[model samples]
Target: SPHIVLSTLTSYCPRSPHIMSAISKAKKSADDARDAAAQVREVLDKIRSALSHHAHDTSLLVRLEGELVAPANDVIRMKTYTETAAKFAGHLKELSEKVGERIQLHEDTPASQRTLNVAFVARTKRNASQIKAVLCQAEDTLDYLHQQALSSYAEVVLEKGARVIEERKEERKEEQNRQGKNQS
Candidate 1:
């Protein structure tokens, strides 16, 4: 078969051993960089998750405060901050996968025994910088989301408190009317 013959010839071809070695080193470096970036993304995801949980807790706290005097229907409202944080985390995860896939480790890599290590180090630094940039952007987004959640929760608590005061006033008015009717 023509295809079989070509495949056999290509397999038997004597490639430069030095070039192969260089390629292997570069591949290893690229893989390491990709792994590092993935780890950084994971850490950032955890940070975002923690922030979301805090937001949830804050909302819950506001709800508890409302329970002391506010009507059941007027209790604090849970804000949408946690969901936003989750979305951001998901985006970061997708980005991490893309970065991992883009890391190309090929056979044409320079020889590891020589100055190739220096090149590898420089490339690694660049990859790290890119990862850091992505993380910074994620942090900024999460911060804004948290702030919105906090404000929403605060507003709910205030509304609940106001509703409770109005209810108390209505009760007092009804009590005064009942006493007047009894005297008549």
Candidate 2:
């Protein structure tokens, strides 16, 4: 009777708590990531909207293209902006790669007899594509973000470098003056 009772208790012990905990953690992570992705997606959407509005309101896009082709003072500014934009663009791209790795991790989960279903595979494929599309747009938006960030950085660096060089020149002049006074 003791052995029978022990066996029954063990058999009846709930597996739900452990399973639920895992599911809860996964759900929390999914929600957090989705929220973050939504924020980034909104940014990308706004950028696209702004570009469309600009093109609609003015022929800026067309005229800008013409200006871009001609050799002018703007070329240096453009090149500087381009370099900065590339750096931000790289950061955005890195974020996209993280999303992709997460998606692949989800897709790679092994099927089990206790929870196996064809729908799981279907949904996984659908979600992967949707997330991939969002990531791609994020990469595209990086172009604008990079340009803005880089242009600002370039300006700051130029200002700082010029000031530093000027300060060094002044220091050299001061040293020469001290040397001349000593000689006199």
Candidate 3:
């Protein structure tokens, strides 16, 4: 965003509006990206809250073939996805902060001290676009993880219910055999 401000002070091509237009478009993209990152943060916070509660309760869920058949495992998987999302958001946040520093550096230097270059401006725009792409990927990953978690929870619930029914059936059969022997 600072680049947007700085460019207004020094337009390399005085009559060319193309650079200004590109900067405007890139600024809008960065703003959208920042909003997307905020949404991701909200999701991660919820996941962290749920994960903390269920992580300790993993022992309560069913186990099959020595594997954890539990929603906690699903939440754990979701956490990994959230972590990747957080990483991209953090990078974007850091890059934006750099703009402030760059602005300060530009201000401290006299106009005659340095020439205005468009390459840095172009690089900043590219970084914003790249960060936006990363945020999009993060959103997609979160959605996929959410779907997997719902399916996994249902599967674990079914397995637990089935195991309970099977155990009861065995117990009842044993009782009936003992009763028959007693009656005989």
lDDT of 3 by residue, 36-155 (tens): 444555544443333334322212211110121132233333332456445444544443444344444445555454345455445434534443454455455545544444444344
Model 1 error, position 34 (Å): 29
| TM-score against truth, every candidate | 0.45, 0.29, 0.34
Report the candidate with higher TM-score, 1 versus 2: 1
**Model 2 agreement with the true structure over 37-143: per-residue lDDT tens digits:** 34444554443343335422213322432332222222223343455334534545453454455345445665362136565555544544544464465445444
True-structure Cα RMSD, model 2: 28.3
Q: Report model 2's TM-score to 2 decimal places.
A: 0.29
